[model samples]
Target: MAQDYSKKPIEELMAEAKGGNIEAQNALAMLHELGLIPEASAAEAARLYAKSAKAGDPLAALYLGVMHEKGAEGVPVDKSIADSYYHMAEKGGYHKAVDRLTEAGVGRRTILLVDDSASFRNVTRALLNKCGFDVVEAPDASHAIRFLQNGGRADLVISDVEMPNMDGLEMLAIIRGRLQKKDLPVVMLTSVREVGVLKKAKMLGVQGWVLKPYDNDMLVQIVRKALVA
Candidate 1:
């Protein structure tokens, strides 16, 4: 059975995560990334991972890097970003990102990852970055627009279904309206298993759907296919 994380408070979550608890760490990171907790708490979660990563935690480093790249502490967003901490974790023989990077080679593919969750964004960002893709991130619709305005171009766009200020659908509409290029590949990551949502997304030209609690192999396959298509 899936662990019930909904009942755990942030402090307890942090404590458990810091105490070598992978599930707690992942859960806390997800909550921080998704804004289920106060935005300020995201920073706290990031701090927890700093310690965890030093102790050879790959997920911790991955999450921290995502938070930094996505500006979890209300910092300005910068897509071409790296986290030394994550690199340190990688150097400690954590092959999660290194393996992907090794297989992906140096030919860079640019990917834009837009989501409200700091944890999820970081984890995804790490995966893509390791896969030899240039990763850009936006917390919401407005941020995404700002990124594009500042000369961001992506081969693929991955976004969450529900978000504050602007949802993925709204962002997709804006992209279609403004970009002269009409065939950009867009994939939606959603926990909402509603058929109506999927149908609407298909109607609106969404290229793919990735369910949450994703399998890394499946994600890589979909991304590779999307980039090639």
Candidate 2:
């Protein structure tokens, strides 16, 4: 008989979590935080994360930092709390979370690209490189905020509107309201053509729009125009 580990029961997992199993706690935290379980509670997720973090789990600390930083999963937007967890994660040897604090800094009109697509990010990065602008990337708004909060600079931001977790408009609102980066130029790259959406972007002070299936030359031109404008 072969043993199957892929089908662990939730009851068993919950029991493990109750028994001080750090990994199980983290797993449960994520499940609730991301709403994988029906009617999942963000508060419960935060509590689980707290337990795991107290046990010195670096990943849990990192996640708590992210949740606090982004105000997601009902963690409440609190940089002080986020900073504490980030520090804990770093001290516990989580390099990626720490590395955000040490981004190479920016030079020569840096561009921040926000999107969830890996291939798109790669292609855009290459294009921007050839255009002679330094490029920084964030898979989502939270990461972008983390980059900026941690000392990364940007002359312009090109973002896709529709994204999981947090959309570009919400990100822009945070950028303008919370971060107070009012003067930053933002370009929207999306396939959406809804009037309501465009109106919202305009109200948010979007500097430009580049529709998807975009032409290489046109995008480069828009970038140039946005930089100079």
Candidate 3:
């Protein structure tokens, strides 16, 4: 899974990354993350780093930890996820990730949770708030947009798809287009299995999803994985 590379050219690196080489993936991800190449893209960097880190590359894990900590474009500010990646790097003998982790002291990450049902919000708020998230409740998409428009700060958004007035996707479009918070990660809580809706959400840059009526542990796990990756 891990092979030592001897300073290959960009073409070679791209080829190796395409062939599922973890080190090559990390190397190319670094070049993209640093804008060292013409094809520099934060989303692509995050995707490559995620693949390498998932395959247990220490350097890739460290870079992902930094991206989560700093809220880089493709990744958001998620201390819980950042710390987990740092620990993975530490286990792989990379001490720099741990050093930076100790240097940055911050509070719990905040999640803007938009749902129309007051009862559902209460349950979700209790669940996430207890699990290292500071959840901000928005009864609907309009309220969510109002909060963001009023200069509200949210590290992530977890919103339900269907509601009385505005659907979550519509609010997501506004968030991506007008609000110009393209990097802000969003997760959808949806019962609809329509491929078009999910594709639209993907085009709008949603990070992940949790189907409606989700298990408590599974929802948290999905949120954590999305936060880091």
Candidate 4:
């Protein structure tokens, strides 16, 4: 069940949020979004939603989707971007996010990240965003594919080898063979040194292989290179 935050003072909620309590963070963000507190601010709500979302809070991510969809409180009005946040929330177990989010105008290249590790996606997402790219994430290959099939956009895709539902090599094959996105750039981010898998990915036209112990700068650089190629 969600935390009961009804009786708690706003100051207590702020303190708990500051202490990294995800539920408290959402509660405080809701207050800001709803103007329930005298000092409520939509910008503050956006910040808290972003923080909690990155930490794997589904509802917070959903709120971010709403923010992006409506351009609320200085967030850009981008339906595609909103859907990206919605996908993130759905992957974290908050289903019912809008599935038919179409492509937004392609000013910034959007990268679809297919990895099961939320922490990894959250960190790399921040890094890529800092480098001027918009990043969307999925927990596995199926989710990544689902996003694409649902009118989601991606300029490049970075996927891990080991996934809970479908392995990355199989995903690459499907992307190349089934989806017929042969020209879509793909980079494998994995620690596996298995030559067979690497060869298969190469045959499938994978652009790059970045190991798990990756340099953030190098990964960003590789993604930039792939987008241009």
TM-score of each: 0.54, 0.53, 0.61, 0.53
For residue 217, what is the lDDT in candidate 3? 53
Q: lDDT per residue, candidate 3, 46-161, as tens digits?
A: 78988988898876787777677656665678999888888898788776555543422113678899999999999999988777778899999999999999999998899999
lDDT of 4 by residue, 1-229 (tens): 7666655677899899999998899778766764446777878888998999999977778777767775655567788877888899879876545532222212468899989989998988887777667888999999998888788989999999998879988888888887889889998888887767866776777877777888764465346435533
Runs in model 2 with CA error above 4 Å? 1-107
Candidate 3 stretches with Cα past 4 Å from truth are: 1-18, 21-51, 54-106
Which pairs, if any, clash in model 2? none
RMSD vs true structure, all candidates: 13.3, 16.3, 11.0, 18.5
Error of 3 at 201 (Å): 0.7
Q: How many backbone clashes does every candidate have?
A: 5, 0, 0, 0
Candidate 3's C-alpha lDDT? 0.77
Looking at model 2, report the run of 10 residues with the lowest lDDT sum. 98-107
> For each candidate, what is the lDDT?
0.68, 0.75, 0.77, 0.76
User: What TM-score would candidate 4 get against the native?
Assistant: 0.53
lDDT tens string, model 2, 1-229? 5322124456876888899988788767755753445677868888998899989987788767666765654558888998898889878886546344222222357899999999999998887787577889999888988887787889999999999998999999988888899999898888877767866776787767777877665466456545533
Q: Give the clashing pairs for model 1.
A: 33-117, 33-118, 33-119, 34-117, 66-122
